[model samples]
Target: MPGRTRPIDKLAAAAAKCTKEGSVYGKCIMADYNNVHKDKCITEFLKLKECYLTAYKKR
Candidate 1:
């Protein structure tokens, strides 16, 4: 596994690339952790998901 990239490493890289989106999504979730409802943060989550997908595809 010397030259092979680990799956976790790839994930970390993608997360780093999507930090802004992730932070926004995380904040939205934390804002209402007790009474979270469906689609409450769907917009933020979708943005984060798109960022991660784009980052992963670039690898």
Candidate 2:
């Protein structure tokens, strides 16, 4: 799986990192499918979203 990748991989990897490093934003992103943490981490999520969008556009 060295070169393997997927759309959700970024988010999933951040979520895993959150588990180890205790990132509330990561937890919010990982579990807030319902937007419960929207107000709390909107800026962080937007940054992550921008990264995801940039990567998506490359492929």
Clashes of each: 0, 0
Task: Give the winner by TM-score.
Answer: 1
Q: lDDT of all predictions, in order shown?
A: 0.94, 0.58
Clash pairs, candidate 1, are: none
Model 2, span 1-59: residue lDDT tens = 68878748765654444333345457766775665633677776666666555555555
lDDT of 1 by residue, 1-59 (tens): 89999999999999899988999999999998999999999999999999999999998
Model 2 — TM-score against the truth?
Answer: 0.41
Residue 31 of model 1, lDDT score:
90
* Model 2: worst 10 consecutive residues (lDDT sum): 15-24
Cα deviation in Å at residue 48, candidate 1? 0.2
Give TM-scores for every candidate, taking all chains together and pairing residue i with residue i. Answer: 0.84, 0.41
How well does candidate 1 match the true structure in TM-score terms? 0.84
